[model samples]
Target: MIDKSDVETNVVVITGAAGLIGKAFVRAVAQTGAIVIAADIDLSAAEVVANDLQDLGKVETAYLDITCPKSVDILIADLMDKHGRIDAVVNNAYPRNANYGRKLEEVTYADFSENMNLHLGGCFLIAQKFCAAFKAQGFGNVVNMSSIYGVIAPRFEVYDGTAMTMPVEYAAIKSAVLHLTKYFAQYFKGTGIRVNAISPGGIFADQPKSFLDAYGSRCAGKGMLDPQDIANTLVFLLSDQSRYITGQNLIVDDGYAL
Candidate 1:
């Protein structure tokens, strides 16, 4: 039997490690004894996240601009030089333009294209570069952060009283990410590489009470998830326990997508 504690020695890279879900992933992976790279475009924020989790385990910070190929290359190179091997990478960055989040009717083509390029394009670049490194190393794991909205259409009724509407670009990007996971998994079938995605439900971010209630009605329990909820699932995917699972999208949306 493989000792799960062996994961403690693994080097894990999680992009967007300063953000909500990203921070949870960093904490969870660090707690497992893995050396975690809390990477984000905001170096200071990533450092703060690493500092907070240092006592739990080995946590490092790095500047990672997911949309920039040069930045991604540098990060991969630096980590390789320092850690010797990268066991897993979490494609969890969420990049977008200033004009993002507008309603469908208000969305411009330029805004949509730019947001897609930033978020989805960045996702592709991260997976491409990391998977290539994994191939050379002979083994690796990848976990992507998709959304429940990608699994199903937006429940627009939940936003009836809130100032939020599902961004069209988000739906497109996430849905494509699901397929992308499968693509990477299939393309690397013979290689010792595994690729998967996590589609999380709406995370609790202190939204309007009305919005929460409307959203809650759709869920069987805990309509809005905490960051840890999704993080736990990611840990499972990164572990050897899921060694045989690949080319899959695990939905962690608490039945909300049903």
Candidate 2:
């Protein structure tokens, strides 16, 4: 009975809109006629994405530093003033400083804590505030961005000669995100809000041929994925068709997790 047509019934907020995956999501959602808020810490980059998507549908750019409580407060207030309602939120961000992605031996306690606070903590803050608002309004959806690493350990063999090695913080943070999705889904049991997560595999970003070959061997077909692959799955989760789905972690990894 929901107006699933492109009638601007949904005001979707997406963090990390500057990244490849986030940008792809913005485009996909905008084309569906949702009032897309292409939010990112980098205001300029978010604006760029919003500008590109304006031709397709109603899209706006907003600054969001999810790690900061005040920034989160302002984003919600601003969105409320402009749109009056938020139908869904996509916690698709990876806020990090330079200390990330260091080798196992080089990582410090400070690095691990910082990454978790920004990534995991941010998701919590966003979900908490949105769930409260959604409870009052009586409907909402949340999609947390998780990783395939969270579902299965990394294949160290894939990075044998490449400069790429999985970041310890990422695995920990993503695992938490997946569990948090389940927690919130159960916690908001009676509320009309639904919480879910998506775990994506290695996306094709022009990696080295050797790395691609190694990774491909582990996948069902293509070793690496396109940003659109993840975006497509998100569309289904955000729509009314998925109204009955919640607290589930959908993996879009070309059978890599299997």
Which candidate gets the maximum TM-score versus the true structure? 1
Cα lDDT of model 2 by residue, 15-79, tens digit: 99999999999998888888999989999999998887778988889999887878878888898
The residue-level lDDT of candidate 2 at 65 comes to 88
Model 2: residues with Cα > 4 Å off, grouped in runs: 1-8
Per-residue lDDT, model 1, residue 74, is 98
Quote the RMSD, in angstroms, for model 2: 1.8
How many residue pairs clash (N, CA or C atoms closer than 3 angstroms) in each of the candidate models, in the order given? 1, 0
Model 1: residues with Cα > 4 Å off, grouped in runs: 1-6
TM-score between model 1 and native: 0.98
Per-candidate Cα RMSD to the true structure, in Å, reads: 1.4, 1.8
lDDT of 1 by residue, 1-258 (tens): 334585888999999999999999999889898999999999999999988888999999999999999999999999999989999999999999999999999999999999999999999999999999999999999998899988999989899978999999999999999999999999999799999999999999999999999989888988999999998888889888888999999998778999
